[model samples]
Target: MNLSRPLLLASNSPRRKELLAGLGLEFKIRVKEVNEDFPEHLKRAEVAEYLASHKADAYQHDLQNEILLTADTIVCLGERILNKPANYEEAFEMLSALSGTSHEVITGVCVLIKEQKAVFHDITKVFFKKLTKTEIDYYIRNFQPFDKAGAYGIQEWIGMIGIERIEGSYFNVVGLPVQKLYTQLKALGLIS
Candidate 1:
C-alpha cells in the first residue's frame, strides 16, 4: 500500500507492529514513553481510546511530513478491565477469571497528521472454553504473557485450545484492528 505521507508508528508493541506490517503499509517505529494512566471513570473502549490519544499527543510536536499512528488494546470482563499482568500469579488469576467467559477486546487507534487527528476503537467479543487450573498454570509458566493485556495472546497456545469463538475481528484481539484502521486511513486520504 502507498501512503500519501510517511508513516510513523508510535508504539513498541511487537504484535501491533506485526499487524500493521501485515497490512503492507510501511512505517517507521518511533515510540516515546508516555503516561498510560487514564481517569478511573473511563470504561472499556474509552480507556483504550484515551491511552492511544495520549500516546499520540506525545508526538504532536514531532510531525513534519509524516502521519503518526498510535494504538492501545484493552481487555474487559464485564465491568472490569484486565491490564497486563505484573507477574505469574497475576497472569494465572487473570486467565482464571477469563475462563469459561466472554470478554471484549478493544483496540483504540489514533492517526495524526500535523494538526489533524482521527481516533477510533474496534471491539471484539471473545468466548473462552472452560479452562482447567493446570492449563492456566501451564500457559503462564511457558508463555510468559507479562507484556500482553489480559495476560493472554489470542494467537498463543491458550487461545488455540481455549477460545471457543470470537464475534469480531480476530486481529483486534491480537492488537490492531487492521480493517477499521484501513478504513480510517482511506477516509483521511492517506491511503489509496
Candidate 2:
C-alpha cells in the first residue's frame, strides 16, 4: 500500500499493529502516555471516541508530515463499561458478569494530520455462552488478560469455547475494526 503521508500508529497494542499490518500498510509505531480518562456522563461509544481523539491530540503539536492514527476499545455490558482489568480478581469478576450474556464492544479510531482530523467508532455485539468459574479462573491464570479490555480476547481460548455468536465485525471485538478504518483512510485519501 502506498500512503500519501507517513502513518504513525499511536498505540502499544500488538493486536492493533497486527490488524493494521493485515491491510498491508507500512507504518511506524509511536506510543505516548496519555491518560485514558473520560467524563462520567459519556456513554459507551462516546467514551471510546473521546479516548481515541484524546490520544491523537497528544501528537497535534509534534506532527509535521505524519498522519497519526489512534484507537481505543471498550466493552460495555448495558450501562457498565468494563475497562482493562488491573488484576486477577477484576478479570474474574468481569468474565463472570459476561457469562451467558450479550455485550457491546466499541472501538473508536482517530486519523489526524496537521490540517485534517477524523474520528469514528464501530460497535460489535458479542454473545457468550454460560461460562464456568473454573473456565474463567483457568483463562485468567493462563492467559493473563490484564491488559485487555473486558478481561478477554476474542481470539483467545475463552472466546473459542465461550462465545456463542457475534453480530458485527469479529475484528472489532478483537481490537480494531479494520474494515471501517480502511474505509475511513481511503475516504481521507491517506491510502490507495
The lowest-lDDT stretch of 10 consecutive residues in candidate 1 is: 11-20
Report the Cα lDDT for candidate 2. 0.95
lDDT of 2 by residue, 1-192 (tens): 889989999998999999989989999999999998899999889999999999999999999999999999999999899999999999999999999999999999999999899999999999999999999999999999999999999999999999999999999998999999889989988886
Off by over 4 Å in 2: none
Candidate 1 global Cα RMSD: 0.7
> Worst lDDT window (10 residues) for model 2?
183-192
Tell me the number of clashing residue pairs for each predicted model. 0, 0
In the order shown, the candidates' Cα RMSDs to the true structure are 0.7, 0.6
Error of 2 at 176 (Å): 0.7
